[model samples]
Target: MSIFKSRVNTNSDTYNKNHADSLAAIETLRSLEQRAVTTSNKRRPVFEKRGQIPPHERLSRLLDPGLPFLQLHSLANYLVEDDNPETSIPGANLICGIGFIKGVRCMIWVDDSGIRAGSMTKTTMPTIISLQEIARRQKLPLVHLVESAGADLTTFLVESWAGSGGMFKNLARLSAAGIPTMVVLHGPSTAGGAYMPGMSDYVIGVKENGLAALAGAALVKAATGEVADERQLGGTEMHSTTSGLVEYLAEDDTHGLEIARDIVGRLNWNTRAKPPKRRPFDPPLYDPDELIGVVPKDYKASFDTREVIARLVDGSDFEEFKPRYGAATVCVQTSVMGYPCAMIGNNGPIDPQGATKAAQFFQLCDSANLPIIFLHNTTGYMVGTEYEQAGMIKHGAKMIQAVSNIRVPKISLYISASYGAGNYGMCGYAYEPDFLFSWPNSTSQVMGGEQASKTMGQIITAAAERRGEPVDQELIMREEKRIYDYFTKQESAFYTSGRVLDHGVIDPRDSRNVIGFALETCLEGRNRDLQPNAFGVSRM
Candidate 1:
């Protein structure tokens, strides 16, 4: 009860006052948090700016309005050890969710660039893995918006050995499973970060702001003595055009997001299955005769196949994918009558084996769920030692495998020359289309009679010269012409008669209607066998 007792009482009184004030502050903070959450809920799905506009808002601008964002890791709460106080966020650096674009829902994962350059902390691996798992389980399209400086140095030891290696295995599995994965390059993306786009079926980028590369210019310079800027290093212009690294090059971030959304819309099963909501057309229809003028009458004269596609698809409804990737072949998604379909056509005068790109295009078609339309007019794959040196055998085989895998509805229209492996690749007898329509002007055969004639002529000349005899040039020419006629006219009749070719003849002006009827008929059959769902496996 002396000086010590008096001091203790004084300290206890002061402690009680401070504790009451702290409790009041806690209640006030709770109320403020509740208000914020309520306000956020009332507001449209807007992204919060941690250090920059959140990925959801960035995606919101890219997608159509009111499309719900199905978040994959909405409740992922984790922290890094000794994390930078100034830059740390509760979820570390990764952000993953599911969202819709024009009602096309897709699983999305974007890096939070504000948090340690969007580096992946140890805890971040599960978020990505979990998202991918959900996407695979639901057969949803997977979209990745990468903007990272690679793995966090502090967490690399724990995450790299235990986190990413197995996680990427799942990513590769999801891709191979045909989940329709797409990657968008909104900003610079490097290292393991770059692989995200590489693994996806389609890669998109902003022309100037987006950058994607296996290694940065600095790293490349370190590995190999070379000089190049960021654009040369990984810019969209370089990757989109020169390297074929990126499929679609957008003018800006907003455009890139839109392109991504458009791509998803085309590939998503939910979107593709619907018959396009456009006004119905007459039963028997065809492209305008003007399309004839659009394509050069001369086979040697190459014109943009896209123009032909534009003419055929609903007015301005054709959406091209991987435009820059396969220069020799064209792959696009468009609606004939509001129904999504994939079109794979040769770009120029065909090659001997057909376009090298044809095989790739065939592979894409085989993997997709929607009906496919083939605008057959390929010369064939390029030949000679050059093609052999290019490993045409392996690449062409890859395409053959893809074509064989197609189980969906397929319609092939031979608008011009459908020769050799090219014809086979374009749903010729080998691929067995549900319906085949040969334009009145179209010719179908194993290979171009003109091309085969040339090769046969050379062999005849060489053998005659080797035997020291005068070559019967006239006889040889006659024989070659005979070979051409047999295949061009006779082969068409034989195959059509045998039911091997499906439908034999169509009018050039009615090519669109021919395709429309074929697709419509096939889709009618499909509906009888299949019932579509809100969420289903998407196109590759």
Candidate 2:
């Protein structure tokens, strides 16, 4: 691995402008994630009065002190119908992330119950399913902080409800696959939602506050004319003493978290398997802050991908996989935070040769068991017959095939444009990267808005010519504007990320740390040992 020589002139006016733009984008990402918390915090008095711990606070307690918690999908469903997209404070009413619990890495899922009592929204189930999927693959223990209000009846969507069965199915599969799944009930989990604790390997419920029931008292009475209250019907006491649904009953939220920690410790998770040693070298030679200056907010603008790799890999050392061959697709073998991995980034369009280069690279990396980092910045597979005859489609498919079937962890970053087949080739969301993140300025769509509108304009003109009619330039202009506006609105990082397209929008400067954390998590999961059974832990 040779050191990447510096080329970015950070002192230039262009770089300075880029730096300013990047800062604003980062600020927006930070603000949106924080807005979700402040909105939930508005009900602090109500929760504290009821002897309940707020969701975020409970999460803090459960995680190891001072250790980083990679918050995922922070801005899930940020924009809503009829809300001003510009200022919409988005949250799925759930706080989900990966963090360490008692030195054991686990997926932490908390219901932001403070917001609408952490009601189940359309975004809720998918978010959890994504988290569960990550937990299953990463071999992470699932420790959920349950406190959701049941389904969001007000804005119910049949599709979400129909698809929700997969969530429980995944939970069952996690435990069956020898991954420990635990849930602590801090408050009410009613109706279908109660199944979360039922499927977990460990269940801890807060005494009076915890309630898991098929129906709350009002619903129960409405249907069966029963007079049982929540506490009497599904409190921790009853579950622990009589039904045996709850294995541990705690006095309060803090106490429940304590019990969860004790369970993790007792499981001897760390002792089950030896963690693979990693040679942690020094930080990148260049300042990560230079990343902002190096990457223009305009996704179309060209910038060397090595500028990013330099800021990310240890000691700015990039082992270029192929220096001159198929140069548009930059392939490199590198180490992020001492954990060895290979990175594939796009310099421009994925040409036929570049596509094959990347395909071969993915195969070699997978064989070496090194995690692959994808920095998405391609305009997609190159167009034009010169490349098509060169087998662009098939070659691009080979890259996608390799990315799709690779067994090693795939971590992706949407650095800029992630368009068309290039997205799939670079391991986009549908490819299911272990962690998918985006920079605030990143834009993703089938193609750029300008490009799509122009292509449509050309088609409209061609169709008009075929009919031997006068060119309707007005209509063409109208259609092009419409196409451009539609694509532009949806291509923003905020818009796609709000839909949970990627994990969340991240700051350019933190890419190294974030990627390193993901790599470490994947490594631990691959090595950790767990007890497997026919069904989820018997009692659960």
Candidate 3:
């Protein structure tokens, strides 16, 4: 493999400016995450008083120490519930991520019951569905720390109710697909939420706090004139002894988490196949801290994407694929954390040659069974007469086709801008990459705000000129600003992340660890054998 030579000037004014800007953006992300943590932490006293562990603490205890946990959608419901942003909470009242449990990689979903008693918000269902999709595709075992109080009836909508069935459907699919679903009912899992533990392959319930009933006392009294205490109806003792809904019963939160971990350890999940051979790998020559300076805060400003690759891949060693042919679209074959992979990044727009090069590279990785990582930062495909005449459309289509049909694991990270069909060509979320994440400064849209404004303005002005009508300059300027503002707001990483455009916004420094984990997950799925059934295991 060829070692990638560095040409970046770390001391230059441009690099300093980019670094400062990136730091600010990263700070914004950090603050938002801190806010969510602070919001959840405030309820710890209450949870402790009730003899329950906080959601985050439960996750910490369950996961293997020192292992990387890639948290998803940390800011899921930001500024959505009310006009006053101060009162609105993020994270959809849930804490979900992928982490190692007893040396087995698994998806952990914890209900942030400390916050608002873990009421289900509008964003909750979609977040759970996204987690399920990841678990299914990546073949990761799923562990749910259930403590939700079910849906908030006051804000309920027919659409949410109709969509809620998808949660249970995915759970069933997971079982049939041979992915184990382990759930611990730390608190109430009533109404439709009762199915969370019922559909799981392994269920652990805490003694007095655990409850899984279709109808609680209030609901039963109102629906059938039957009165019963919640614990008597569906507590740990009742489920474990009477109904057999719960496979194990624990005395408290710590015991319950220990039981869940023991279940994962006993599954023999990792012994299904021989583990991949470990290879000695060198760390990148460049300091990962410099990653803050690599991606410019201003999306319009150009920077070398290789500076990014230099800090991420092992030993800064990268064998360029078609370097001279498609210079703008950089395709390099490199290893990440000792795992062989392909890295595709953009120096600028995707020209005809770039598209063809990327498509061919995709096929090459597929042939070699190497996972592909996308570092997205393109304005999009090039346009205009000369490029169009050169068959840009057809070439871009070929790139998209390769991305859609690739058999190997694909991961994407939005380093800066991901616009237009470039997003599709680079394996955006719509393409359903095995893992999709974004940097704090990343933005996504059909096009840049200024580009959208100018394009619309040109079209409107042209029509006015053709009609021999006087153009209202003020109105046109106002219209352009409106379009620009709209795109600018929606293109933010936070906004896109809140809307579930990607998996989550990650700190750039965590790129290598996250990518490594994701690649391992995909590899496990590819290697493991599953005993599939036409239908999933049922309660009966």
Candidate 4:
């Protein structure tokens, strides 16, 4: 492997400006995240009055200390209920991530019941379903911390309710795939939600607080003349004694989580070999913190994408593939966290040569069965008549096809712009990257706001000319700004991430470690053997 030399001037005026811009953008991201945390924490007093700890407290108790937890979609459904970021809560009212439990990697799915009793939002179902898919794909045993009031009826969508059958069905699927599914009932899992505990392979419930019933006590009383309390209907004791829904009943919530840890400890998962042995390597030569300044704040400004790859790869060493042939498209053979992998990145728009180059590189990586990391920062595939004639369409299609078919794990990271067909070719949200994440300052849009607005202005101005009338330049400018705002609002990493577009928005410096964790998970998932049976672990 060739060592990559650094070209970025750390103290240059341009670099300093980039650094300031990156910090502001990251601060904005942190502020939004803190809003969600504060909003949830407000319910602390309420929980304390009831003698129950908050949901996150339970999560922290469940996971092993000091081990990494890969939190996904921390900002799911941002600005959905309200445009005012100060007042609205995002994150699907769910704490979903991957973490180690007793040294065994497992999916951590905790309901943020602190927020309106963990009511479902518009994006809640899809976010959860997607996470469940991730868990299934990675073979991570799923452990749910259940406490919910079902759907938020005020913001209810009938389609969401109808589609929720998949949530229950997924538990069964997870079990059938020989992936263990467990749940700790922290509160009510009533109505159709009752199946959450019913379908799990293992279940722990807290007495006096936990309940899982086809109909909650109040619902049962309303439907029938016979009245019953929740304790008699679906309390942990009742299920442990008669219904067989809960295998373990605990004295309280903390004890329930303790039982869960013990259950994971007994799985004997550590005995199996997962990922390949780590290769020897040194840390990257440059500071990873320089990632903030590596990409210019202006989306259109050009920067060497390798400046980024240099900060991320092992020992700052990598071998560039087809360097001079399609200089715009960068493909490098490198490793993250001492695990060998390939990196395909964009320095500019993809031309025919760039597209073909990427396709060939994808083939090479696939043949070697090495994981591929896609670094996105492109306005799009180059356009114009000359490029069209050179077969940009077909060549771009070939690259997309290669990405789709690669059996090796694919991870997509948006370092900057991810626009138009370039997004598709780089394994954007739709292509099913094993894991996808973006920087706070990055964008995911069809095109840049300025370009989109200018094009709209041109179309409007052209129509006025055809009508034998003059268009007002001021009006056109206002129209342009309107279009610009619309596109920009939807494209921010915060906006798209809230809609379940990316796994999460991350600090640029943490890119190496975040991608390292993902690579490790993917490699282990790919190699772990599963014992498939006809049906999942259903209660006898």
Tell me the spans in candidate 1 whose CA falls farther than 4 Å from its real position.
1-287, 296-298, 349-368, 473-500, 529-540
TM-scores for the candidates: 0.42, 0.97, 0.97, 0.97
Tens-digit lDDT track of model 4 for 1-540? 699999999999889998999999889888877777788889999878767779889899999999999989888988876777677777889988999999999999999988888878888898889889999999899999999999877778889889999998999898899888999998889887789999899999888889999988778888996689878899889999998899999888889999999999998766664556689889999999999988887888999999999999999999999999889999999998889999989988999999999999999999999899999999899999999999999999999999889899999999899999999999999999999998988998999898999999999999999998999799899999999999989988888988889999999999999989999998888778887688888796
Tens-digit per-residue lDDT, 295-394, candidate 2: 8888778999998999999999978877798998899998989999999898889898899999999999889998999999998999998988999889
The residue pairs that clash in candidate 3, if any, are none
| Candidate that would win on lDDT | 4
Give the residue spans of candidate 4 off by over 4 A. Answer: 465-475
Q: After superposition, how far is residue 229 of candidate 3 from its true place, in Å?
A: 2.1
For candidate 2, list the clashing residue pairs, or say none: 78-90, 113-118
Candidates arranged by lDDT, highest first:
4, 3, 2, 1
lDDT of each model, Cα atoms only? 0.60, 0.89, 0.89, 0.90
Looking at model 4, which ten-residue stretch has the lowest summed lDDT?
268-277
> Model 3: residues >4 Å from true position, as ranges?
82-88
Worst 10 residues of 3 by lDDT: 79-88
| Candidate 2 RMSD computed on C-alpha atoms after optimal superposition onto the true structure | 1.4
Displacement of residue 469 (Cα, Å) in model 2 is 2.1
